[model samples]
Target: MKIVADLRDRFGVEPILRVLGVAPSTFYDWLAREAEPGERELLDRGLLTEIVDVHDRSGATYGSPRVHATLRRRGIRVGRKRIERLMRAHGLQGAFLRRGWRGGSTKQNPKATPAPDLVDRDFTAPGPNRLWVADATRIVCGDGVLWMAAVRDVFSNRIVGWKTSDRCNTDLVLGAW
Candidate 1:
């Protein structure tokens, strides 16, 4: 909004962005659509309606890439980046990102309890039962998540104790016990 107001007021983008703590490169990206045909560049009411059409036909899951592809297939020839900028200006966006595996933290906390770097980092133990280890992991099914608790006998490398439950309450661990 600030950038748009700045561009509208002075016919320049860089200075306003600088005054408002935005980078010049971002303003330049917004200006990339300046090369489009005048009518298409404006993304007026009719074009905006069409953009919404394209966006919705995709179940609202299409970002500019898929939206542009859909438009191109329908005989519209707009750059993907241009579509992106127009979408931003109009406050239209695709669905939020789909959940995925949470990235593991990488910061080595000097104060964090340090695992003895087991297997000497080998990650491979020669014999089972030699290294009894236990762990609890979670799995998500239709309705809710289930916690799986297990103890592996390092000597025979066999699961000696195992339990699964929808809850990880003490009872669940006791059940495994």
Candidate 2:
């Protein structure tokens, strides 16, 4: 009512307030208690510091979800949406990833000569030296990814001989054998 009287005496503000579904009195009341420029900047700076701190402490690994958790852990009350906004503003992000089972048995090639299935998936032997199964798996080492060919005794399921190389050449399997 006071705002309507004040606005009526000054510039026209009733139509705009009516369009926004808020009373002119309520809008003027909010304007009176609005945050100044300096206060808003200070709040933004503090929030940015918290965001950066959480990101660095996470070894740059935390996404918005984890960052939200970290903020709550430190007693900083924040919502996930707010954390996401802050992270976006700072250009901080987590690693990209694909979801699914990673590696599996390769489809048997019709053209290429197949290594005989000596064990026929039995994966069992009566004695230690009776059967040996071989397969190649990749491992990351100091210098680069190393392709390792290993032979395991079916009886004990223990890897007996293994060799690693930068390339998946026959030498790796032969050397392991």
Candidate 3:
């Protein structure tokens, strides 16, 4: 529309409007809108400014919901869908935690035999070392991830054996015991 306004003097209005596929009545209506802005247009324009500020302050991480919440906290009453519409029109978006689709991380070996459940869901033990349960966890370290494997004696309610390593696998668990 602005291009049509600027180049209309040089090339002419109808030619540019025809080339741009915009109706003459639509262009004239736009001119009238510029002359006297509608209430919704005025409100949307003001909201756009506030939305941009909130988005920028969040380092462009916040989406329409967060932006709307911030506006409401600051005593600005506006609908979330309206913020979404305005942000979409202006090409604004929140940062995504994950950019694209990814497959599951786990893969089981088809040929590997399953371990028998010796405990059979029962954890009670009358004496120490009669039964032990093990668990493994990974901790994010500065250099790398640390895998920790631990075994607990049910009777004593204490850790019987434990081990930590950079690599996590069956060997680490077996070695921990």
Candidate with the greatest TM-score versus the true structure: 3
Q: What TM-score does structure 3 among the candidates reach?
A: 0.56
lDDT of candidate 3 at residue 66, scale 0 to 100:
96
CA-lDDT, candidates in order: 0.71, 0.79, 0.90
Native-referenced Cα lDDT, model 3: 0.90
> Which stretches in model 2 have alpha-carbon errors above 4 Å?
1-61, 70-76, 98-114, 139-147, 165-169
lDDT of 3 by residue, 2-100 (tens): 898899899999999999898999999999999999999999999999999999998788999999999999999999999999999999999775765
lDDT of each residue in 1-177, candidate 2, tens digit only: 445546755656777578658776786775564544467557767987998898887678789998888889889887898779878988999755568745543555789997687667787788889998888998766456779899999899899999988887789999999
User: Cα deviation in Å at residue 145, candidate 1?
Assistant: 11
Per lDDT, the best of the predicted structures is: 3
TM-score of each: 0.34, 0.53, 0.56
Better of 2 and 3 by TM-score: 3
Question: In model 3, where is the ten-residue run with the lowest total lDDT?
Answer: 97-106
Give the worst 10-residue stretch by lDDT in candidate 2. Answer: 100-109
User: What is the lDDT for 24 in model 1?
Assistant: 76
Per-residue error for 34 in candidate 1, Å, reads 24
